[model samples]
Target: MIAVANLAWRSVLNRKNTALLTILTVAVSVVLLLGVERVRVQAKESFANTISGTDLIMGARSGNINLLLYSVFHIGNATNNVDWKTVKDIVGQPAVKWYIPISLGDSHRGFRVTGTTTTFFEQYRYGRKQLLSFQQGREFDALSDVVIGAEVARQLNYKLGDSIIIAHGLSDQSFTRHDDSPFEISGILNPTGTPIDRGVFVSLAAIDAIHEGWETGTKRATGAAFAKDYTNHEPTAVTAVFIGLKSRLQTFSLQRQINEYRFEPLSAIIPGLVLRELWSMMSVAEKTLLVVSGFVVFAGLLGMLSSLLTSLNERRREMAILRAVGARPHHIFLLLVSEAGLLTFCGIIVGILMLAVLLLFGVPILHAQYGLVVDVWHITEYELSMLAIVQAAGILIGCLPALSAYRQSLSDGMTIRV
Candidate 1:
């Protein structure tokens, strides 16, 4: 067995160029296969961990996905605002513990502006029930103060006390700007790898104070003084509300009551369930990517098979020499199989190194662009199973060429084919 392995190693080195190319092909395929799986798993984890400790997310009547997108993700505008009276009535229930009302529809240089109370900083939890912490300064205290997320602060180069003007709507180039009421950067949050990292938070009263004369979508030029006393300013409506229950057992009951409320059209959703439903809807695309990666791996294995089969013709005389030297027919088969196994094993090692380098550099980019935190060194059971399957397939593929070589050795024993 050792002699056959040594001979196989020498044979592969004799055609070093082709062997290297085949290894590279296999390595690239492995990288793609493993990379897709890693990202898929990490993305689901990031999505699920985006918001936690909140029992329910309530907003104007809309689909669960829509409510999640607008309220939690700040992805789109809400269909309608939940009246303050309705919001108060819902939070006043005996089952409710704490509630944070969020108002949207404002932007500052493409970053979303969220209007909520200081309770948001205290009550909002993410990633294993972690509370929000400031990286630079304290939370907003004055009406003109604003708290920016990590990405927002980094991208905008905002420092504490830098005043930023917010636009009237979500557009980066809005025609109506709230120039008269600029907000001072009071705090910057630590990176959470979630939508919170891209948001600009302010008091809900600030949302109302900025739109004092913009009832028609355009700010009126009236020389009205901007309200400084947030104590007197109150928001009449909000885009959505994040609710926490006194006891988790009352979550479903309150959800049912809110959904069936006759005073207003409302939708209440559990974040985890909606996220699961969203992932289910997106699973088709995920599976499609995985299938494409599988085909790529198959193509790489086929390339290896082609290389082995092509080398058989050139090595016909070599096989005759081995057979004349008292080597058995099974020895030739083992030699070929050993060569394929070595190539696959080496390719897997190289692929893992490549994946490590990729994750090392890609972690920051993914977190910055999509708020996805990918672990560099975590290998799941599924990935190990994939590697095992690839190894088995490679050895099986080598059988065809190995059998051909075995038969040639028998027919052309002790004689050169040429």
Candidate 2:
């Protein structure tokens, strides 16, 4: 067996170019397979970790996905605004521990502007119950004060104390700008790698203050001076609210109560459950990617099979010489099988190395662009199992050429075909 293995090694080295190409083909396939799996797992993790510690997200009556998207992710416009009176009544519940009112429908240079209370800075939590902290300055205290996120500050070149004009609508180019109510950047939040990083936060009063005398979508000529006394100006409605309960056991009851509220139509959703639903909806795309990768791997294995079969005729004289020198037909069979196994092993190693190198450079880019943090060093059980399956399949594929070599050796005996 050892002699056959040594002969197989030498034979592959003799056809080094073809062997290397075959290995590279398998390696590429392995990279694609493993890369897709890694991204799928990490993307889900990032999505789930975007918001935590909040018991429920409450908004005007809408689909669970729509409420979550518009309220938490700032993805879409709200269908309707929750009455501020309803918000106060719900948050005043016995089970409610803290609440953050969210008022939207404004923008600052393409970044979503969120109107919330100072409690937002104190109560909002993310990944592992992490609290929001300031990288510079402090939370907004005054109506004219605005707190920008890390990404907002970085991308817009904003600094604490710099004045910014808020647009009336969410569009990047709004004609009706709130030029009268420019806000000063009072704080810059640390990056949370979530939608929070892209938000511009201000007091709810600020939201109403900016839209003073605005009727419908256009500003009316009130001719009155912009109200600087924000204490009197209050938001009559808000886009949504984030609520935390004193105990998680009461989550379902409160959700039911809020959903059945009589005064107005409303919806309450558990963030974790809604996130799971969103991920399940995306599972079809994930499965499609996996299937495509599997096919690539199959094609790679077939490439290896083709290489070995094509080399068989060229190595027939070598096999005959071995037979004359007392090598058995079974030895030729073992030699072909060992050659295939060796190529596959090398390919797997190269593929892992390639993936590691890619992650080393790709992780930062992904995090910067899409807020996805992929752990490169962690190797899951699934990956190890996949590699084992690939190796076994390679050995199985080798048997075809091995069997052919065995038959050729038996028939030719010590005769040199050429």
Candidate 3:
């Protein structure tokens, strides 16, 4: 057995280029497989952390998931805004714990401008009810002051005291720009990997004030252009409101109450349900990526198997000599199998390292583009399962060439086959 194993090692070394090429191919495929798994899992983690603590989300009558996307994640626009009266009534309900009224319909560049209050800093929580903290500066005090999310501040390169003008609508190409009533950057929030990290927040009164001037076609004080006296104007409505229930058990009850109320039609959605629905929509694409990664691994393993078989033919003489030295065919088989297993193990290791390196550089870019925060360093059970699959596949497919080599060794006996 020892002699046969030694011979197997030498035979593989003699054809190092073919073995190394097969290893590299399998390694690269494994790397891709691992990378896809990491991304899928981390994307889910990032999404799950996007909104937390809010027991229910109440908005104007519309798609439940749509409201969650636009209001919670800043993904799209709200078609309608619920009347401020509806928001006030909901907040006044006995079952309600706290509420953060969000008004959306404006943008600075592509980033969303969210009309909110200083209560947002205290009531809003995420990633397991973690309160938002500032990285620099202070919260907005004046109506014309704005607090920027981390991504907004970083991407726009805005700093404390930097003035910015808001557009009339929720678009990057808005024709009506509030160039006169520019707001100063008062605060910058720390990165939370949530929509807050990609949005600009101001008081609800500020949104109303800016649009009021647009409605009259003249500033309030000067009755000419930009004016600051519109703060006294009444707000018509808000896009949506995030309601935090006093108790977890009150969620469904409060949601039902809001939906059945005689007030204007509104939609009350459980954030968890909307999140699940959103994930269900993404499941198909995620599964497709996993399937593609599986195919890549299969192709790589087939290549490795073929390479091992081809090299076995060249090592027939070497195996014959070992058989002449009293090595059993089973020993020869075991030796070949071990070498193949070793190659697979090495391939998997290289693949993991490759995935780590790629994600280290890719996380920030992905966050900046899609506001999806991916934790690169964390490994989930799903990824470990993928590695286990790769290892098992390598061992299983690797035995085919070993079986062929054992057959050749038995037949060749004492004679060397060229």
Candidate 4:
């Protein structure tokens, strides 16, 4: 078997240039197939890691997915806000460890504004209990002070002490700008590859103060000079409350309590459960992408098969030369099959190496644009299975050329075809 394999290798090397092109075609396909698979796995991982350590997300009664989308991902708007009294009542639960009351419905240059206390920095966790760290400066010291996420600061070119205006709503062209209540950047958060990287954080009191004197869909912002004291009238409502349980065992009990609260209709969800549900809803689209990639790989392999089949015609004399050396018909078949297997094997190797290189260069861009963190150091079982299937398909396709060469070597046997 080993000697037969060597003969196969030598024959392929004889047509090195053409073989190289075939290998490259297969390599590109492998890259696309594995690339899609990696993204699917990592996207789920990135989403799941965004809000770890929080036991329950309490918000106004609505679609569970909706509350999650607005409060954590900042992808949508909340239909209703939770009263501050309700937030306090939930926090007062004996099972509560700490809570961050978040108020929304505001924006700065298209990025959502998150209003919470300094405790937010300490309590909010992501990517495996990772704490939020400041890239520069410190937490906001006053209501006029704001903390920007890494993306917001970079994209908006904001730095410490840079003044920023808040809009009354989420739209970039909201028309109601809080020009009178400008905020100075106090801090910038380090990149977390989560929603935190895309938000602007401010003191909840500032949220109230900035919107001071506004009522009936009107904004009456107070001057920046006295706006720092706007906390005297704290916000009477918040969009959501992030809750951490005293212990993991009490999470379900507290969740049930929040869901059954009498003051106002409320919904409490486990971030992990919501995340699973979210992915389940999106599984069809994900599978569709996978199927598309599978066809890409098939097309690539078919290209290789065509090259192999075409080369057999040219190599018929070589096949007869092997026959002259006491090489049986099976040896001729193995030779052709081995060449096909070798081409695919090399292609898979090159494709994986290319993906690794891409990941090294793409980490920063992916984090900035998609909040996706891909691991280049590891390959999961699913990836291994995928590679195995591709390799097997390559060997199976090789049989097409193998039988052709076998019949040609027996019949032609050094005789030239006219």
Against the correct fold, how does model 1 do in TM-score? 0.89
How badly does each model clash, as a count of residue pairs?
Answer: 0, 0, 0, 0
Score candidate 1 by lDDT.
0.89
TM-score of each: 0.89, 0.89, 0.86, 0.93
Clashes of 4: 0
The residue-by-residue lDDT of candidate 1 on 188-260, one tens digit each, is: 9988889999999999988888888787877768643255565866688999999999999999999999999
Q: Candidate 2 lDDT, tens digit per residue, 1-418? A: 8877888888889889999999999999999989998998887787887889999999999999999999989998889999989998999999999999999998988999999999999999987788989989999887789999889998988899999988888765546777767799999988778899999998888787777678677764554324567675658899999999999999999999999999999999999999989989998998898889999999999999999999898888888888888988888889899999999999999999999999999988887666677778788999999899999999999999999989989878555666
Q: Which has the higher TM-score value, candidate number 1 or candidate number 4?
A: 4
| lDDT, candidate 3, 154-216, per-residue tens | 888889999998876755543567765689899999887777888898888888767664665
lDDT of each: 0.89, 0.89, 0.80, 0.87
Tens-digit per-residue lDDT, 1-418, candidate 4: 9998998788778899998999899989998998899898788787788898998999999898998999999988888899988888789988898998999988988899999888899989988788999989999987688999999988988889999888988765545888787898999998888889889998888887767677666756345534354645557999999999889999888888888999899999998899888888988988998999999989989999999988778777777888998999999899888988999999999999988998899977886676677888588898889989999999999999999888888787667673
Comparing 2 and 3 on lDDT, the stronger one: 2
Pitting candidate 1 against candidate 3, the one with the higher TM-score is: 1
lDDT score, residue 379, model 2? 84
CA-RMSD of model 2: 2.7
